[model samples]
Target: MSKLLVKLVVNALFTVPLLLYLSNATPFQALMASLSLSILAFFLGDQWILDEFGNAAATLADGLLAALFVGAMGTAYHWGLSWSALAVIAVVTAAVEFGYHLLLRRWDVRWYS
Candidate 1:
């Protein structure tokens, strides 16, 4: 709950601005995309992959997932985000995810339970 909220806030802080600047998306669109991406990343990357595959693998998986997810959303929404721009967004988000995974490790939240 708290972890998910924090992740949402952090992801929105990074994603919304990037989407607005890079894709010329409206604030509502950017925020919706950010929220959707955050939920997907939290469940798949932070919850499952992080527990099963460890940090480095989880980070890489998260980055790839971010790229794919955002790319799909951009296309669907006609946001016109380029592959290179998507890469930049994924890299930045992955960097933050790396630190976030570390924090999750420290907190030892009952992700499964």
Candidate 2:
């Protein structure tokens, strides 16, 4: 539950602004998309990859998955999606996620087994 809370907050803090300030998404749209992506990342990146391969590997997976996720969501909303833009977002998000994982370690909090 704590982990989920972190996911919600962190994802919202980053994604909401990115979508709202930088893209065409409304606040409600940003909220929905952020939560959706956070849950998906928690399952795939934290659960499936993090335990097995550790932070670096999991972070890499997160980047790739994020690119795909943001792209799909952008398309769904008819935002002007582009590879360059998505790549930039992916890099920034991945860096933040890497730090977030480190914070989890510092807090002695594990999101998954």
Candidate 3:
């Protein structure tokens, strides 16, 4: 699939359940956040990190960004803080992303080499 499609799929894969588990989360809020952050990641997290290092470093950076975004939802929604929730979202996202990036890494290495 194309990069854009992959991003959408990844965002959907992670974001939907996250919103579901958050309790009292609005789909609109979740969607807006995902839309904006996915764009942010496309630039700040993905392109920048990839240029600065490699896929592994980008993965780490993406995880951090994802974690922060997930953690911030409580604050954004005035639902107070939920550290455990944030940690779960971040870890799940990171694990999923790591696998995705591994595929990308293989393709990228082959494509580049």
lDDT winner: 1
Using all chains and alpha carbons, the TM-scores for the candidates as numbered come to 0.92, 0.87, 0.78
Who wins the TM-score comparison? Answer: 1
Ranking by lDDT: 1, 2, 3
In the range 1-113, model 2's lDDT, one tens digit per residue, is 89878877987888778777667777888789888888888888877787778899989988888889989999989877678778876877788779877876777655453
Q: lDDT tens string, model 1, 1-113? A: 99999999998999899989999688999999889989998999888889888889889988898899889988988989998899999999899899888888778956435
Q: List the residue pairs that clash in candidate 1.
A: none
lDDT of 3 by residue, 12-60 (tens): 6786668666645677777776766667676875557765676777777
Query: What is the RMSD of candidate 3?
Result: 2.5
Off by over 4 Å in 2: 109-113
Name model 1 segments beyond 4 Å from true.
109-113
Kindly give the stretch of ten consecutive residues in candidate 3 with the minimal lDDT sum: 104-113
lDDT of 3 at 18: 82
Question: Candidate 2, after superposition: displacement of residue 2 in Å?
Answer: 0.5
